[model samples]
Target: MLTKQDIVAVVVLYNPNKKVYDNILKYKGLVNRLILVDNSLTNNKYLFKNIDFVDYIPLYNNYGIAYALNLGIKNSTEKYILTMDQDSAISANLINSYLKFLNVNDNNGIGALTCQYNTDRNPAVAKKGYVKVRQSMQSGTLFKRSTFDKIGYFDDKLFIDVVDLEFFLRMKRSELSLVRINAAVLNHHPAETKVKKILFLKLKYGQSSEVRNYYKARNLFWVAKRYNSLDMYKGLTISWLKIILLYDDKRKYLKAFNQGIKDAKHNRLGKYYSNYEGN
Candidate 1:
């Protein structure tokens, strides 16, 4: 069993809401240290300046999750790092479980441990105590800090979406263990838009805005191109098509999709903004 001091919790903030602050309170005794990497454009950085048991680093811009996470990891001095989103909450015993699992798998080349979460596409492996999966989200994951040296940090070029998948694919290729616990600690669905079931076809996961759509499509395309996997290629085709067909304002969504494809083709990345014309 691992003690609290052995783990460090890092939360990436980008225009987070009130829940984030409330959750920060819960993290106080959960781990020995708490780090908040603020990427908000506004003056939200002031909120963390003198907080007890917290170290705040404000980027003052939307640098995306990957950058903030890398910053947090660099600042951490613990054996294990627990990465969390502003709105993420996990099982109370999550740390204990991770400690147990890692203790058992320390000599088995385990790089990280991910937890079960609510998702549109549920997998059967989640029903088991532990499942060796190729993909796991960044949030609700506990990582062995040394693994960063083995598998390079996240690609800053991808920016946001598919960032976790890219890292997962790389880990899978490296033969590193990426296991997901059956207990669903991090049950979060930030995207509250209702899923539109289309005439007996696949369900459309409603998106928040055009900006998000662009990142989603572009990053997926970029990953698919590099990985050259049939599932990714098929996902790339099907996902954007659903985004276009299911959105209320089809023209704006289609435009974002096209722009994403164009940017990916030209190797353009980092923060890109739209006029919010149709928003």
Candidate 2:
């Protein structure tokens, strides 16, 4: 079975709140070393200064999620690596269960063993055994240390949104599978989302700002073009419709969405920067 020495944990931070410390405490003791990759505008080293067995890497700028995750992976040498977000936490029992499952299962073709975490968009349904999933969120997911060497690291070009899904799809392209450990629970707090009902149709919308909408649109198109998937286009179209119809700041969102499309077509990526907009 995998022990504390066999696992390294990486948590990406972005101007995290006090609750992040509480979340970090949940799994800090379960791993040999916990790495905090801060992508905040300023250094937050004081947060983990008193914590033992934890290393902090401050970027001093928002380098995006993919860059931070890759940096953490590069600095670790453990057999298994657990990736967590500032808003997610895992229990000791969940870590032990994941370790036990890894020890018993044939992990040759498994890209990652993820937890049954709930999301505002899609909540995980509990089941008796694990389920094979096409893609999964990055938080609360345990990856084999060598998985990157096999399939490659997360794409740095896409930046923030859909970084996890892009990695999962890349694993799929390499014939690797993602397994969700239904019994392994993780407390993952997604962005604030609300539901709207119109003529018997219930629509869920997230509190993603215009800047985030830009990434969502651009990355979706980029991934779709790279993978040649019509389903991705359909999904993007639905999101566009939702933003136009449901979002309070529809004009700003629409402008960002259009800019994202133009940039994607021109192959422009890796952090969105515009003279008129400040992010």
Candidate 3:
């Protein structure tokens, strides 16, 4: 059984609303510490003094999710860190489930244990039970503090898209185990998507702005090239093909793809140029 002092929950915030606060409160009692990394453009410290366990760290600007997560990991004083996004939801038994899973598997070289998250993405996951994976999304993931020493922090250059995947790749190179528990489920709402059947294939894709398309293309190329992993490179290549081909706004996405390839060649990373018109 994991006690309150063993785990710290880090939830990153970006232009959050009252519902965000409400969601945070739901999980506060499950962990030892609750830390909020506020990346809002406005400088507003929202330390919940009433709840001594909660600590707020405001960046006053959008530093991206990777940066915020790295800051949380550094500030956490617990044995393990549980990461979540503002839009993530989890089963009520999330903490205890992870604790139970860790108790037996922690000694077996498990660096990060993430629960099965239902997403529209084409992630390679085992169909059942606890299965080892190369990468999983950040939400509902429990990572050991010591893994940072071996694998380093999340790649801040990634900014948003593929940050978790890049970090997990580093963990793999260091021989750290990345496992997912199929029973411990996480409900995540990723980019809105509708499944469409084209001939014999079922394609899952959604509308994405030029900004997102740019990041996805750039990061997929950058990380795949940097890691020299043919598996990821080939996988992302196919996924990108599907998104670009099946997307409703193919012209804009095609333009974004070209921009991304250009940016990746120039080594332009972090937050790219976006007019902040839409998500």
Provide the overall lDDT of each model, using Cα atoms, as 2-decimal numbers: 0.77, 0.83, 0.79
Candidate that scores best on TM-score: 2
Instruction: Report the C-alpha lDDT of model 3 over 135-193, residue by residue, as the tens digit.
Output: 78888899888998777898999898888888888888888899888767777778777
lDDT for residue 103 in candidate 3, whole number 0-100:
70
Total clashing pairs for each candidate: 0, 0, 0
Runs in model 2 deviating more than 4 A are 120-125, 200-203, 275-279
TM-scores for all candidates?
0.88, 0.92, 0.88
Residue-wise lDDT of candidate 1 within 1-279, one digit each (tens)? Answer: 568789999899988667777777777667889989888887675666566889988887888889989999999999888988888775556776777766665654788898877654443323547888877788989888877878988788887888888888888778788888775466556565566766787663646677777887788887888888665677678767776667678877788878888787777777764433354
Give one digit per residue, the lDDT tens place, for model 2 in 1-279: 667789999999999777887777776568889999999989898977888888999999988899999999999999888998887867886687788788789568988898887676777554567889887789889988778989888898988888988898888888888998887877667767888888999977676778888888988898889998676687689879888778787888888888888888989999864543643
Better of 2 and 3 by lDDT: 2
Candidate 3 Cα misplacement greater than 4 A, ranges: 44-51, 119-128, 195-204, 275-279
- Which candidate do you rate higher for TM-score, 1 or 2? 2
Screening candidate 3 with a backbone cut-off below 3 angstroms (N, C-alpha, C), the clashing residue pairs are: none
lDDT of 1: 0.77
